[model samples]
Every structure is written in C-alpha cells, then in structure tokens.
Target: MVTVPTRVRLGYAVGSFCTANFTTIPGLLLLIYMTNVLAVDPLLAGVVVFLPKAWDLVANTLVGQWSDRTVSRWGPRRPWLLGGAAILPIAFVVMFIGPPLTGVPAALFVGAAFLVAASGYALYEVPYKAMPAEMTHDYHERTSLLQWRMIFIAIGIGMSGILAPILAGDTVEGYRLMGLVFGVILLLAMLASFFGTANAPYTGQAEPEASLKAQLRAARTSKPFMWLLGLSSAQTLGAYVMLAGAPYFAAYTVGSTGATTTLFAALVGPMLVTMPLWVWLAKKLDKRGAMILSGVLFMTGAVAAVATPLFGPLYAHLVIVVVGVGYAGLQLLQFSMLADVIAYDGMVSGKRRGGVFTGLWTAVESAVAAFGATIYGATLAIGGFRESDPANPVTQPQSAEFAVLIGITVVPAAIILLGVLMTFKYDLTSAKMSQVSHDVT
Candidate 1:
C-alpha cells in the first residue's frame, strides 16, 4: 500500500490557496479592472489579457524543463517553490496597482505587470502540480491525495472570490488593498507548502534527467496527455469565462452586487459538498467517463444560463448549483487523470519528465484562461459595453447584456460540448493506469 502522511498532504494542499487566489479571483476581476477602472477599450484590454499568456506558453515549459535538471539539497521542485513564493506575490501586487496612465499606456503597464506575475505563478504551479506523480505511485492514493488538494482549492476560491470583489467594490483603491491583503495570504500559503513537504520521498524524479527536447518528444507521444490538454483547454474556456464574467452576468441580468456572491456560492458550495461524491465516482467510472459526465452537467447549466432573462436570478443560481456539481467532477478527474498520464509515461518512456509535462499543462491552462478573457472582452466590446467608471457607473448597452449572456452561456457551451466529444476517444482507463502503477512501484 502506498500511503502518504496527512501532514505532508495538508502542507502541499495549502499551496492551492496561492494558486486559487492567483488564478480564480484575478481571472474574475482583472479584465473588468481594465475596462472599468482605467477606461481602456474592451478589445484592447483583451489583448493585454492575452500578452502574458503568450509568454507563459513559452516560459512555463522552460521553467519546468529547468527545474527537472536542477541539483540542490532541497531537491528539484522545492527550491523553485521558495523562489516563486517571493516573486509571485510581488508580481501579483504590481498587477493590480493603478499606474498613472490610461489608454494604451495603461494597457501596456498592466500587460507587463501581468506577464511577470504569470511567470512567477508558473514557476510555483508547474512543479507543485508535478509533485503528485513523483510522491505517490499508488493509483488510488493519488486520487485521495488530490481530493484534499481540491478542498484547499475550494477554500481559497470561496474566500478569495468573495473577499476580492467586496474589498475592491467599485473603486481602484479598493482593488489595490485587495491585492495587498491577498498577496500576504498567498505568500504565507506558498511557504507552508514548501516547508510541509520537506520529508516527502522523491521516487519518480531520478537523476540523469533527459534533455528538454527528449522530454518534449515523450510528452508529444503520449496520447492521454494530448487528449487531457485539449479537453481541459476547451472546457476551461467556458469555465474561466463564466468565472470572469459572473459579476457582469449578475449585475446586468440579476441586478445586484449580491447576485455575484450568490453565483460564486452556488458554484463553490456544491463543488465543496459534492467533491467526495465525484472522487468516488472517479474510482467507479474512471477519469475519462467522469470528465464526460462533468461536461454534460456543465453544458446543461450553461444552456440554462442563456435563459437568465426569463428565469429569475434565483432560478439561474439553482441551475448554477447543477453546474457546480459537475464542475467538481471535471476539476478532480482532470487533475488526477494528468497525474495518471505522467505515471503512465514514466512506465513506457523509461524516464520521469513530470515537470516538463506539468509545465506544459500550466501553459495550456494559462493560454485558455487568457483566451477566455480576451474573447469575452472582444464580444463585450462589440456589444457596446461601456468602459467602467467607478465614479459614475456607465450604463451598458442592451447588446452588452447579451454579450455577458454569451460569455457565460453560448460560447462556453459549444466549446464544452466539443470537449465532451473528444473525451469519447480518450484511451486511458483506470485498469490500464492501475497496471502501470503496479509495474512501476
């Protein structure tokens, strides 16, 4: 039996505080800040959102490849964690502070700040995500371990998602303070994870690392890897957009600041409550099936969201709970499945390149999120959503309301439906993964 200490797991899971805070909350708030706070053109702001992602696509892979070859007393991944702990928080803070510029200049400043923040985040996340495959070779144990991590992810999302908007309510200064407070929390969480996993045995990360090119080649050859990447990237387009656009959806469709909170809770509450059910389902149905099931649930909720104007916001939230239930399954299985893919790769490829693969994973995640924000921003720009002014709230055009509807509904539903079809062809199964785990361990 491959068992890990609960202490180590908690320590590692704590890192999700930083990851969730950085990914979820900012993803929700940033584009709005650009359009509303600085009065940037929505389409141009989307371009700013996209620039850092382009960098991460290249940067995360390089960082992951470098970390794999690192030789240090603390081991390969841990040292990067500490560096990330320092850099990401500082970068995060900079991204939110309003520099005394507007239009293209303001866009340029935010784009630069976000690029640095994304780079620091990738440094921490890629190696952290890769750690699961190295720490446990047990097929089910990895799932168990990741369930705990998902719990931390939930906590971070709930706390950050609620706090950020409340703290930054209708003002630039408020956002700055929100950034500072969350920056401190993020720093603390990263340190806990770095120190917490001090005693974890490094099983999969053997020395004599492969060249970056060879590692890339192996990841390319893994069908399971490619499938997960495509499925996740496609679905995340909807997921990130829903998260990023929820405020707009609530404000325009539901007509209350509180509605955004309700939306957040509807998603997070069910996700927290039903995670165990999803984990168990993964055990019974396998990751691929679970993901497809999740996709269906997500599509159903998104389609329901399209009719927000007809149903009261209360009913919309009820439907969101359904989406949340499915999101839990997708969230857990995708992560656990990736760990399985890496383990499988280690078995057949004769090398451990977990960092490189995970780096690529973060790269894809970053890209999709960036694309989500940009696509939504462009759509809103087309729909005539007014640039935000905290001093005097701009009345959005009728088309902008429909744009939020599309971002939260139509575009995402189509993409998720496509991703669900892709899952049908995914060949990795629990039985195959179990054999891989047994052979390796």
Candidate 2:
C-alpha cells in the first residue's frame, strides 16, 4: 500500500507552482515583449505568440503516450520530471535572451527557444497531471488532491503576475530577469517533488501488449472524455484571450499599467483566500453544479469587464473583483473534475492510462491557447495596434478598442457559456466516481 503524506502532497503542489512559472510568465508577458520591446507589429506578435503554443497540441499528447508505457527503476514519470527540471530552465532563459541579430533573425531565435521550452513543459506537465489519477483511487481524495494542487497553481500565477512587472524593470530587461528567476524557482520545486512524493507501485495494470493505435482508439471512443475535452478547449480559449489582452487594455484603455498588477492581484487573491469556499461548494453541489455556477459568474464578470470603458475605472475594477470570485471557483473545480474523468476512463478501460489522457488534456489546452492568440493577434492586426507608444493616441483607435472588447468580453463570454452547456454531459457524479473507485481497486 502507498500512503501519500500531507507533506508529500504539499510538496507536489509546490512543485507544480515552479513548473507552471515558465508558462505563466510567457502567457502574461509574451505579447508585451513582442509589441513593446521588440517592436514587433501587434498583429504579427500575436501570431508569433499563438503559433509556438500550437505546437504543444501535438507534443503534449505524444509525450503523454510515451510516458504511459515507459518502464524504469526510478519509475516512468519521475525520470521525465527530473530531466525537465534541468532542461526547461535553460530553454526559458534562452527564450528571453532573444536572438543575436535584429528583425526576422531575432524572431526566429525566440520562436525556436519557445518550442524547446514547450517540449520541456510537456516532459513534466503530462506526468505531473497524471499523478493525481495514479496516487489515489478515492473520489473525494481526488478532489482533495486537486484542491491542494490548485492552491499551488494560484501561488505560481500570483508570483508571476505580481512580480514579473517589478522584476523586469523595462520590458526588455524585465523579461530577461523574470526568465532567470522563474527558471531557478522551477528547478527548486521539481527537486522537492522528486524527493518528497512516493510513487504508488504499478500493479501490472497497464496493458503492456496494447498497441499505440489500440490505446488511441479506446481514448477516442470515450464519450465523457470527449465532452470534457470540448468544454476544456473552449474554456482555454476564453482564459487565454483574457490573459493575452488584459495588459494592453490596462495600459491603453484604463490609462494605468499598474492596473494590470491590481487586476491580477484581485483575480488570484480571491482564489488563494476562497479555496476552501470553492472546495466546500464542490462537496455540497458536486463538481458539475459547482462548475456551472462558476461559469455563470465568469460570464457575468467578463461581460461587465467589457463594459468598463463606459462605466469608468472604479466600476470596472469592482466588476473584475466579482469576476475574480467566479474565476476562483471555476479554476479550482475544473481540474478536480478532470481528475474524476481520468478515474472514470481508467475504470471503463480496466487500464491505467493516465499519461495518454493527461497528454491529450494538455494538448487541447495548448491548442486552445494557440487559437486564442491567433484571434487576439489577428484582432490587433485588424485594429492597427502599435506597441512602442504606450500612450499612442492610436492605441485606442476605435478598431483596437473593438478588438480588445471582443477579446476580453464578447468572445470569452460566449466560450464560457459553452463550457456551462457542456457541463451537463459530465455524467460522473462524485457518487458514481466513488463506485468506480471501489470497483477499480
């Protein structure tokens, strides 16, 4: 029997914080880097930002499948984790350093570095995500594990969001310093997780003889998994658009770049404070109910945020606080729900195939990010956004504002609403998941 200590669990969560730091910094700052510092056209920058992540759509799934069948003395997942800890940080530093030459040469260098970082992220993230399913078979325990994990995720987001601006100083040096800081923290976190968490013994539960095609076919046929994938992909797009566009809106629309820090603090602060509330809601209403309620709040808040220009900064900030509350619930509960889905798949297939599922999950997430960047980047192009002049009178060109509004509110709200609709298809209630746990064990 494998027992997960509270300390070990906490260590895993902290490790996730480190691993996510690389991605969070990029997600929050990449657009700023391209447009403001590098003088890339906003539209073109968006494309550059969007395309590299799209590569993850393919990479994440392939890495996941490979990890699942891997056999080793240190176990399958940890080796990848250890390896990524070393490689990802170096890639992250190189990404921010930019290329030796100017213009296209620089852009190509940045893109190539980002590709390497994404691969490293997959190396850790797929196995990290899979651990929840493999660690315990209990339904409530899965929720508990995810809840813990999310707390750390919030920490990562908060640190990256709040500190990146402060550390980076100017756009150019700030990105470079932020990369170095995040890379160091990531290494520390991975080492903690490696030393702390004990792997659950493999029970010969994976089908050693199963062909890759056969496993893919099985995953393809899973209806519940498919529905979750659809919902999650849409949600990813919504979240990414907000992340990518918020800084621009803060600087140009609100007339305050500091507002970016304030907004992020409002968003993540609630998540950290009210995690217990979200966990309770999950327990009382169940994951699907909690998700739907959270989605509604997210939609309401997003719509309200879009209207900020008309309402003025104070009112807009208030609306954002409200939205943060909703975001807190949705973000926490979604991963918990994902853990449940993985367990359900395991029960039905009679095989532990977490690597494949996590891989696919991460792939969809990366793809959605890519898609959102495409939309955001193209919107900037269409709107004629110029990044160099923070105070460019042209920054708020009617077309640009329209694009920001669409990216921040209209499109995100629609996507979130779709997520709510899809929640109805998640048939794995806690009770059902509990039953599945019993049978699988």
Candidate 3:
C-alpha cells in the first residue's frame, strides 16, 4: 500500500473546511437573514437562497470536467483551488451584505452574488473532492482519510453556525459578521491546503482520451454509482428541508426565538461529538450496512419529530439526537462509498475519471438540494406564513402545525424511505472495493 504524508491529509481536511464555510453560513442562517433582517418575504427569501444553489447543477459538472482535462504545473486541481480561495471571500461578503437598493435590484444582487459564490465553490470543491481517490490507492486508508476530512468539515460547519449568531449580535449584524468571519476563515483554510499539499505527488493514473459525453455516458451506466446518487440526493433533500425550516420551527412552533440556537446546537452538536463512534460503526458494518442503519435511525427520529406536539420539545430533541447519530454515519459513509465507486469505475473503464464522477455527484446533489429548498419555501407560503410578523403565534390560521409536521417529518420520512429502497440497487460491497483497489494498484 502506498502511504501518504500527514500534511497531505491535513491539507485535505483544511481544504474541505474552506468550501464548507459557505454552505454552513447560508445553511444555518440565510433564511433568517432574508426574512427577518433584509425583510424579504420569507417565501421569497427562500426562493432567493434556493435559486442560486440550482446553478450548481450545471456549474459543478462543467467545472469538474474542465479540471479533469486541464494540465498545470501545480497539477489539475490546485490552480483552481488557489483561484477559488482568492475569490470566494469576496463573493461571500457580497452575498450577505444584502442588496444595496430595494425591489428588483436587491433580488438581482442576492441572486447574482449567490450564483458567483456557488461558482467559486464549484471551482474549489470539485477539485478538492477529486483529490482523495488520487491521493491514496489503499481502500482502508481512503476511509481513514475521509474520516479526518469529515471531522474537519463537521468542525467548520459547527463553528460557522455557533459563531455566526454570536458575531451577528442581531439578525442584520449576523449576516454581515458571518460573511466577514467565514470569508476570512475560508481564505485561510484554502491557502493552507493549497500550499501544504502543493508538493504532494499526483498519484492518479491516466485515462484514455474521451469526450465529455463519453465520460458522462460511462458514469450513467455505473449502476452502483447511480444507486448511491439516488440515495444520497434523496436523503440530502430531506435533511436540507428540515434544516431550512428549523429556524421557523423554533421561533413559531416552540414560541421562543432563542430556541433557534438551542435547536441548531441540538441537531449539529451530537453529530460532531459522535463522529468517531460512527467511524467505528462504518468500519465494523461496512459502508452499505452503515448507510442502511442510518436510514432506519433517521426515519424513526423523523416520525418522532412529527409526534412532537404529543411528546413536547424535550422528547423531540432527544429523538433528534438519535437521528443525528444516524446522520453522522450517513455523512461519513456516503462519501467513502462515492470514493469506492470512483475506484470501481477506474477498474472497469481503464480510466482515472474521479473528477467526472465527483463533479456529477456534486452537481446532482446541488440540484436536488435546490429543488428541496424550493419545495420547502413554497410549502411555507402555502401554509399561510407571513415573514412580516415575527411575533405570529404558531397556531395562527391553525395551519402552521401541519406545515411544521410536514417539513420536519413527512417529507423527510418519504425521502429517507425512497433512499432506502434505492440502496437495493447498489451492488458494490467492501469486498468489491478491495478488489478494485488491488487491480488499480
């Protein structure tokens, strides 16, 4: 087995940190900022956030394909990494500064800036994701490497969420301060990864020249990959739906704005703390088994969340913690499984096409997530929610309970169930992954 250096692993972790900061900020707070601070209609604010992410569907794949073909002295991935690192902060700052003018100008500014940020994210993220398959050919080592990266990702996400509120001081300041702080953090992490991993050898094997269409066609034909894509996209949509509605749930359902922090913490904190345990479970059960187990846990917790009116917030939080544990497993295993699929594709096609696979994976994921957010935002509007009134009671129009229940439970449960059903199509196992690694090496 080829061994990689500690710095290479560290660089990988830090690189993910930079890219994830953008996701964490908007993921946790953008909705609140739009509705409460900028005073965009809540449903409209949701659309503002939702529209930009849709760009990722096209942009991420194109970026990945372009990176795969490009040759650079720094290698295929690092140049884009450096460029993205430099520009991401500026895009981030623009995204959260809110529109300078009201009406169309404001909406246009938010949408345009968000699209720019998503592009920057694609540049950095697709290359960064493609790195692991090239970095090590060892099956177990890849798992270990991904575990460390996920840990850093969890930390970056947690820190972004925890600190954004503190720095914001209020909704207006929160968006501005979060933009600045996370922007700086992203810059630093990007630089660290770029410089630190610069000398790390490009261990990736070469592929026969193929058109982008051929590469995409090859990816489409991979059954295991398609299964993973379906499962992860569905599961991710559920998670984003729940996350997108969380702030509203805390404020309205629970009758406390402060509950937003508590709810965020409750959801994210356990996953961070239990990451190691999940890693152990993955090792013991294998990625597919772990993922299946995660689906079961999440489904149970989601059902319990729907029962929150009967059980109260305390019980709901406890059940959600159980769900968080499952989420942690899913997060770690899903990417590791993706890596396995990349290796599988290489072994079958006699090509190193990690960039194409990762790019497509990311693109599909972005599209599904964007669609999920759109549905969520539209649902809130249908439920008769008005962003204008912060003090509106949960029982208003007596329809909000249904909205909260659907957002927190029914939607996610259906998505998770679909993901579980799709898993039967995944033929790749740990043994298969091991064979692919052996053949590649």
Which numbered prediction scores highest in lDDT against the true structure?
Answer: 1
lDDT of 1 by residue, 46-117 (tens): 888878987888889988898888778988889999888879999888877857666688889889988888
Off by over 4 Å in 1: 205-208, 437-441
Against the hidden reference, what TM-scores do the models get?
Answer: 0.97, 0.93, 0.92
Q: CA lDDT, every prediction?
A: 0.84, 0.74, 0.74
In the range 375-429, model 2's lDDT, one tens digit per residue, is 7777777876666622332335778767766777777788888988998887778
The superposed Cα distance between candidate 1 and the true structure at residue 304, in angstroms, equals 0.5
Return whichever of 1 and 3 wins on lDDT: 1
**Residue 359, model 3: Cα distance from true site in angstroms:** 1.1
| Residue pairs with clashing backbones, model 2 | 168-174
lDDT tens per residue, model 3, 1-441: 667788787877877777557766676576666555554565677787877788887888778787887787888878888778867778988887764443345656777888888888888888888887777766667777788788887777667656666676445556677788778888899888889788675667676336778878878888988889999998888877777776666666666656666666666676678777767776788777778888888888887777677767787678778777777777877888888788677777777677888888887776676566666777777877655423332344667546856776788778888888787677788788777767656
TM-score of 1: 0.97
- The TM-score obtained by model 3 is 0.92
How would the candidate models be sorted by lDDT, starting from the highest? 1, 2, 3
Which segments of candidate 3 are over 4 A away from where they belong? Answer: 100-105, 389-396, 437-441
